[model samples]
Target: MATSYDYVIVGAGSAGCVLANRLSSDPGVRVLLIEAGGRDNHLIVQMPAAAPIAARDPRLDWAYVTEPEVFCENRHIIEHRGKVLGGSSSINGMVANRGNPRDYDAWAAEGLPTWSFAHCLPYFKKMETFVGGANEWRGGDGPQSIERCPATHPLYRAFLEAGVEAGYERTEDQNGARHEGFHIAQSFTRKGRRCSSAAAYLHPVSHRANLTVLSRTLTRRIVFDGRRAVGVEAQTGGTISTYEASREVILSAGAINSPQLLLLSGVGSAAQLRSHDIAVVADLPAVGRHLEDHQIVPIQYSTPEGLSLSHRLKGLRRYGIGLRWLLFKSGLGASTMCEAGCFFRSSDRADYADIQHEFYPLTAEMGDPEANFDDGFMFSMGLMRPESRGHVTLKSADPSEHPAIVFNYFAAERDRRIMIDGMRRTREMAAQRAFDGLRRAEIAPGPDIQSDDEIMAWLRSAASTEYHPCSSCRMGVGEDSVTDGEGRVHETEGLRVVDASIMPHNVTANLNAPVVMLAEKLADAIRGKTPLPPSGLVPH
Candidate 1:
């Protein structure tokens, strides 16, 4: 790698990889993409069903455990962020969900006109090549390839039928026009292999002479000239090095690290920086505030021994599935085992869907291999728009220290009420007649647990993160917002943060797909190009 480039992007995650591809598309621009982890070309990373293992594997995932959450019985949730090339996309459940369009409209409602769903739709379309074929609502030609999951299993059918039996509509497309209802999920998969951001964007053009990727390098801090970001100081295998940016310093290191890096670089709250002995460059008090994440409560049930995905993962079948994927890229190994999910309102009082459900055909944790004999299915739901907010702050000035995270989950009364409703609603749906053929008994909060108080008690003991953490460096025009709509760090020159960290709020679904869309939109803004015209149709 050279001493300098047009764009020096820190963190080759979902957003950085996209920026590397898009920014480097211009042959004249020299782009440098640096990652703190090694290459993503692993068999475990490629197989779809192995996502759980991939996400928990220390080699790829930055397995961060949060500070004690008082609201959830003081339990510390384990959070996973991608450390490898594609970042979380490489290790996440490859569900291709765009969330509700209303999510973006809410951002526009909060003074970010350019971030409205109407304005963001074009970019979303521009990033994905959905195999279902694109229309006004989907994309046909794009970098990330998405395919509909083959929800052919009887359990999948039961779940879809159960949702309908529970009185919700059976929408054909969850990512398209209808965002509310039960449906088969679409995934970022191409002919059975996981299609991550690196797989889709970076590797394809990595050979270009103007583009350089420095993996296994941790960016310690951003080098600044007064208040302007000029370059990045990083460490590779204990040897410190610096790389300059001729045009800009882009940070797509994700929600946790983006803000953490800003603070470490002397750009956060002055008081916090002073305590750490770091000279404050820009006193952006809201730098690490407003952290948002989804707190999911799983409701599980017993199913026929051979019906659940667990049955396919144990004994000889596991090896057979792996061999099939290794050979023809098909079978259970080709699936994420998260074939179906649902979106619906928790109550009639709510204006939109407040709860999102992920249907998993297994009772065991996604990562544990020994528990494959546990034959059961489950569905998990989280309040889409939570009221509680949290932050990321430094434990010390040391660059190697992982920042302390306080999710403060379920701190608001509304958050608790909605989640209670979500739990009951999930149980109600699973109890429908369509589930009769598969459902044997309720495994969690069993048949005895009834009433609001009982459900709330159970939730406190079981709530866990859906792995969607964002908005720590949210974009807006208020003190709570850390950046502008263009992802430009407020009051900083030649510096930008393009990733989930800049989301105004957590969307109603998985983060990886929307994170890709966010990068696609901001990449144009950074290049100073005219914004894409709004579609002007509000379907959601």
Candidate 2:
């Protein structure tokens, strides 16, 4: 007899892990969580500052690079995604910002019912257990734990001081009422160890009799029975297997792979599918469209003597940090790859606060090479609200084939304008009197690099993704929308998408928290239950 499940959730990532835990809580429904990666119990993943190290380990990461672009000319930007059980959570900077309230309201205004800021705030509360505790708007007793950075680097003080001098206030909570200030980023860590979604949602339930987490199992495609999704075909080792979903199949395979899987399973554009010899399962042209990502221009600065993580870090200091992590679970090791962040509307913009800057008191390349040193207090600036749209297309008919991703970043005039605004704000913040004492020579887009054209050209050549890709299978009520507002595949009987792919648009902050909230809301929507209450607290 084929082993069947009441619910089959593909991709044991942020959303999938949450779904696995929440859905299986009933015990009546047998859930199957399929992961393409392995266990996330590794020490490097547990150590917060060690995230950069874990990102380089092949066992924990799916290191992907974008295809060279005519716009990029020569630079091939690398896109990193976690391949382990925790998914990107194991590799992410761990800064947990739920995004601006306006971003969600904007989605609701765009025809996605119940996706308004009011509707989402509750789910955001329900998915988190904040360490500072919570108010009516925030949850104090959720499965996923959230905490403030325990130890602050000396350079962090410099960055925060700089922001204040630049006229930015020190906001108590970036996740609360006011997001327009400088603050120490709250991380998804507990007692110095990473509290990845897998650690919070999947690990505890992996031993459940009602749930089976299949790691190292690569999903090939969604098996169909005419109009409905009946099962998933995947490969484990050299064996090809099909697992039936008695109730439904949820694709938590993320934005990139979710749409790729849909296209491979013949659910994309008619012209494209036919050319690839894939029989059309659905004529959804938007299966892989409207992709958007935050483009970051890392502003690295040299610290004023003995103040940088780079300076405080060396020889026995490295040994001491390692030992402290292994023993007390407290020290420099207990920190995210990035520490503080600030969000603001550029003085240059009349529109919404469409630019965000992240303060990293440590220096390292965005990805890989554990031994490579690029240390210092480096703040990265990103365009928060982008109007650019892109697409994902399968290169071939084979399910194993990688899809072609074209971000088309700065492809639109509005997008380029936003990048320009972001760069200006970055400079304004860096040039503040607070940083004047510690400021060093410009490492990127130097002083000579001024003017809108020069900035845009630099952006096109130097700016790279923050690794947040979304909206391939965007949610909307329109026919062009791949999924409905409730996250259901249009006209489909028993399949839904509950990952970043379902986002109507990218959130103003990191998408991780919003992704978790979406899954929580989806679980409630599926079970016909009301979501939790919100944290009444506002940013101080």
Candidate 3:
């Protein structure tokens, strides 16, 4: 690696990898992409059913346990994040969801100009290469290959039929004109491997002479010149050192680490920074505040008889499946367990209803739900439009110290009320007569658990994260905003943040696609080239 580069990106996660690829395309610009872990070329990291095992395996994961919560099953929940070259995308269920169109509109409504669905859709199309082929809505030739999940599991098919029988309409494309009702989920799988950001953006370009890819490096903090971010200090190969950005320092770290890095670098609230003896650099109060995450309360039920991956774990059978995955890359090892999912509204939902009902066809046994699974389908229902807010605060000035995360989940009465309605709605759909042929019995909250109080009790005892945490470093038009709509950190000349942390609010679905889209747009902005918008509209 050179002593300096045009762009020094921290954390080779979803967004970072994309930025590294897009920004380095200039050939003239030298880019440095640093990661905290090694390559994402592992077999477990590519296969889908292996995601659970990969999530639990500390060698490839940063298994973070949440602070004790008042409503989370009355215990601290364990959260898993990938620490490899592709970050969470290396270990996450490879669902390629862009959330609802209304999600981006909400950001525009919050004074972030150019963030509307109409504005960002081009970036989405630019980064994707949909396997089913694209029309006007889907992108045909892009980097990420999005395809429909194979019709392998019988229970997933049953779930779709049940939704249709329960008075719901069939939506062909969730990322198209509308995002509602039941449908088979699209995934980021090219052939049999997960098309993570690294695979899609980094792997092909790893040989670029102008680009330097460093692994097993832990960034301690952003080194600053006055209030401007000049570079970063990190530990590589157990040796402490610093890397200069020369032109710009972008923090593409995920929501958790982005905020933690800001706080550790004395770029947060004056009061909080001073408490830890940190000399304040920039008093950005919203640096670690306004944290939001999607909470899922699973509704499980047994299937009478179907190929549900439940019996596959018995004795030598699982090993056989593993052998097939390692050799042929087919069978249960090729894709994620959730073959199909739906987005529907509570009967009384008002403004938008597409932010609920994300079902998965599996059940687990531990704190991180993926770690403990036996057999059954689970419908994870919650308020996709949560009003609750939380934050990531420093425990001390030490970068290695665990940050204090107060999710304050279900703290708002509105959050609780919406979740209660959401649960009722899911159960109502699951009880449809179409499922009568496939489903055996309700395993959780059961047929006897009926009442708002009962549902809330179950939520308080069972709710967990959907693994989408964002908006800790929110973008806005006001002074309180951490970055501008273009992702430029306000007042910082060369620094920018192109990750989920820049999202003003949580998208109504999975966030990986949107994060990649942000990087694509930011690349255009940095290169001073205006790519064609989805509708061919030019700014006045």
Candidate 4:
């Protein structure tokens, strides 16, 4: 007989891990969590500094590449999605940013009243235990642990000081009442170890008898009776199996996979499904539309010698740092390299920050080992809210085939203008007196690329994703929306999406923290628990 579960969550990613822990807490409920990849127990995942390595590790990352993008000079950008137990949370840079509250208010205005910043704030607090103590804006005790980066390095300090010197405000906590300024980053780390969702939520509850976590299980399709999803057909190792979901089958498979799964199960555009020779169940045209991501162009500089993390990569020192982290979980290995960042408006006309910046202490050619060096620092300027839209479509009917993704970045004239302004602003920050002694020369876009046209040309060739993708199965009120306000598929029962895909639009910051909060909010709705009372704090 097929194993029966009260809840079956596909894709043990950020949202799936949280759902497994929260839903199975009742003891009476049986929860099955399926992951396409294996456990996240490797040291590369445990150490915060090893995130970049984990992102490229085939065993840990799906490493999906995009289709050629016209706005990006027809180049295919590599998109890394974590395949391990904790999903992208295990492989990401660990920056825990909640984004601007207004971003959520904008969602509320778009017909998702329950998702406003006022309503979602409590859930954000419910999922995190911030190290700086709790306040009206921060959470105190929660499953996920977060620590503020010390920004102790002179380079980090210079970066923050330079932001202020450039006339930007200095916010103590970006996740607090105000986020429009320069601030030290907060990370998903505790005691110097990466606190991935698997580590924080799933690992702690794995002993629960009613909870079953199936690693290396690839969900092929949703098994539906009539129009209601009743179970999932999946493949484990060399065998194909069916698992019954007595109550609900939540698709927390993320932005790319969730919509793909829905489309593959005969739930997408009628014409598209017919092309693949699949019978249509629900013809939702927006299943894979509205794809959004933060596009970033890096600004690297060859800093004065010995100022970056380059020295740590040298011969014996590399092994020594590894030993220190493996033994005491300290030293350079304990940090996520990206220690400081800022959010600011690109122009005076904007009411809030539309540009975000990240500072990296070490500089190395990501994939080219021969170009790896030890004495440079870099920062990336990312547009917070891009107007350009994109889509994700099935490459074929095969579930094993990755979807074709195209993020038409810079397609909107406003987007291009903002990016250009962002580049100019980044140059201003780097030129600040705070970096006067350390700054050597600009490595990317060089000093020669000065005009607006030159910067636009450079961006078309060099811009890349910040790796935050969402809104493929966007939640809204119309026919174009795949899911409703609470994540229920508009015309389907017994199915829901509880990941970044449900975001009506991408938030102003990193997607990880918001994704986790989405799961927490949805779990309450599923359990029939009363919604937490809004704190009534006005949105900033």
Candidate 5:
């Protein structure tokens, strides 16, 4: 492998894969994509239903647990980052969400006009080939193929119907015009297989002579010469290799690792760097200051035994599901059982939909085959725009050691208030007459937990991450930001961040789509391509 390239992108994640594909398109320039984990060829990664299995397997998942969260009863919440080529996008629930348009418009309101909904729609369209076909708002032809969930299960129908009965409209396309309603899920799937970022972007262009992908190579730190990033020190099979980049070094290691990398490279607070006996490269105090993530509290309801999908997992039927998927890629195994969900406001005073919901057919932790669970469905509800902030700090000077992540969830009063309201809103939707026959007793946070105080207490123990962490290395106009609107590190040259880590704040939906969109847009700027004109289409 060549020891130097024009562009060296760390972490072959959702963002990095896109960068590798787009940047390598110019044969004149060479690109090297480094992945800390091995290849994402496991059956657990290909089959969509095996998402949970892939998330906890040490071979594929980082399985980084956070520092005990004080807001959630001091529970050490699990943070499952995909250790494979596609990163979290490989193991995450394949929900293809772009969040609300207002999310980007708000970014524009913050003085980064290029990130407004109008400016971002083109890139969102550029990265995705919506299975439903394209329009003014949705993209027609793109790399990532997105398909809508069939949501044919009786229970799925009931949940969606319940939302309508609770006075919400059934939205056909959540990613289009308006998203504030109950909708069938859009999955990052091609045919029946999971269309991971690696599968969609990197694998398709593997034959490119200019592109070199190095797997199982853990990047130690950025090698900088007087504030300009030159390359990175990486370890491959106990062999330390240095790869120099003549153009730029991009860090797409997601929210946690990116911040951790910055801190380890002496690019964070000078005091913090000195504590680890590391020399300061730049005193960017905000490197890991605005850690944000969505915390969902599950509201589970027991369904009749035969009505639940959990019943099929008992014996031979379970094996059949796997066999069917392996043979023809059709069946329940072809999809991440998370079919139905919605985006809605907690109350009238709220801005665009402030809360989000995702319904899963089974409540069991599929990761543990030995652990038994009841036959039930759960609605994981969370605040779309969470205000709570936290930080990612190095545990030690050791490069191999995982960073200490603290979500500080619900630290903001508004976050706490919205969560309780969102929980109540979830209950109201579930209680609709549509669920009368299919749904049985309330399984979790039962009838007794009705009052605000009871719900608040229950939330302290129940709420956990939705696996969408962002904003540890935010891009903005102010000093609080680590990067600029162009994704270049504030004071550092030739170093850029193009992932969810650079989000000014977390988007209103899942991070994968937003991260991919971020890369697609920034890749143009990096190549000196003129920015796409902002769209004028208005959301209804």
Candidate 6:
């Protein structure tokens, strides 16, 4: 006999964890949360500094590689999505950024009024306990614990000073009154440990009698009864089984898998469904359209011998740092290393900051585990909102097969121009007098590559993702949208997509925080609660 639940949430990820907690809060309702990956109790996941290692681990990450991009020198980019519980939040560089207020206003302009920054600000406040204390913008008491990066390292101080010297303002809080200028980054951590959605929402409520969490279970497809989603068919320990949802089936499987699951379940374009030999369910051509991601290129420079964090990752120092963290949860392992960053416009033509940059005190070659630098610093900058769009489609009918993702980075001439400006701005900031003592020679794109054509060519070969992918299953107020403003799948009942995939567009920052906020807002909508009143606070 198939088990029954009031709500069956696929993918115990950032969004699913929150949804499971919220929906199961009612003692009368039974909730089932299923995850494709194993428990997130590993040391690498708990330590904020181990993010890079966790991102590369197949056991922790989906590690999906995009299809060759026509614009990005026809190279396949690695797209890492968390397979474990808490999803990308567990493996991500825990930067807690809410993005610019206008980002959501753009969504509202797309016919999603409830998604306007004003309407969504209250939910963003509701989901986080900011160390900076409560205000009109920041939340004081919430599930997710947020910490402001100490920004103690001399290199971090230099970066902030350089930003100011290069004509950028310095704000105390990026997620507070203003999201512009340079500031110390906020992190999703508490007392040194990672504060993932699992840690914040699910783990605390796991003992609730109404909630049942199934880890290491792969959801094959949604089990639909006619047009309504009834439940899901899944595999656990090689055994196939069906779990019925009496009320709703929510897909929180990040950007890539959510659309892939929908396509596999026969809810995508009729032509594509027929080609895959699957009977069409809804014939929604927009199921996997409008894919958006943040494309980043690193501007790296050599630093003084002992100034970079990479110097400490060798021999006895590495072991000592690990031992300290294990013993007291303090030291290098306590921080994600991305302690400071800047948000600024590439040109006056952009309304808000079109370029987002984060600085790392150490550098390593991409895909090279052993190429740790003894002296290096890097700034990774990406166009906050790109004109380029891509799509996610099924490669085959097999549920286990990965989907084909094509993030056509630099497809738009405007996107390429903005990236070029961002690179120039990064170089300008690095050349400031603040870094005169610590700065060394350029590493990644050496000083030799000066011309526009040369820079564009270099970007095509070097640009990669900032790991913020969204909008493949976007929410809007039109026939082209897959989900409604409230995240309900169009032309469908008892089903919704409540992850980053539902974002109308990509936010102007790292996605983990915004995805969590999205889940918080949608959970209230799903529960039919009174909508939180819009804060009406605008950034200065």
Q: Per-residue lDDT of 1-540 in model 6, one digit per residue for the tens?
A: 339999999998899999999999999999999999999999999998888888888899887888999998798888888999899989988998999999989999988888888988898999989998899889999999999988898889999999999999999999988899999999999999999999999999999998999999999999999999999999998899999999999999988999999999999999999999998889899999899999888789998778888888877998888889999999998988889999999977878899998888887554333224446888888888998999999999999999999999999999999988778878899999999989999997999998888889999988888888999999987767899888889888899999999998898888888988899998998999998999867678
For residues 426-505, could you state the per-residue lDDT of candidate 5 as single tens digits? 88898899999888888778989988888888888887788989999998888899999998998889999999988888
Off by over 4 Å in 5: 365-373
Per-residue lDDT tens digits of candidate 4, residues 386-409?
Answer: 999999998898989998999999
lDDT of each: 0.89, 0.81, 0.80, 0.90, 0.89, 0.90
Candidate 3 structure quality by residue, lDDT tens digits, 35-79: 888888787888877887877787788777778776555477777
Candidate 2: tens digits of C-alpha lDDT, residues 142-226: 8899988743555677678877887777888888777678888889988788999998998888788899989998899899999
Clashing pairs in 4: 310-374
TM-score of 4: 0.98
Off by over 4 Å in 6: 366-374
TM-score, predicted candidate 1 vs. hidden true structure: 0.98
Candidate no. 3 TM-score: 0.96
TM-score of each: 0.98, 0.95, 0.96, 0.98, 0.98, 0.98
**lDDT: the better of candidates 1 and 3:** 1
Q: What RMSD does model 1 have?
A: 1.4
Model 2 / residue 2 / CA error / Å? 5.9
- Model 1 misplaced regions, further than 4 Å: 366-373
- The weakest ten consecutive residues by lDDT in model 1 span 364-373
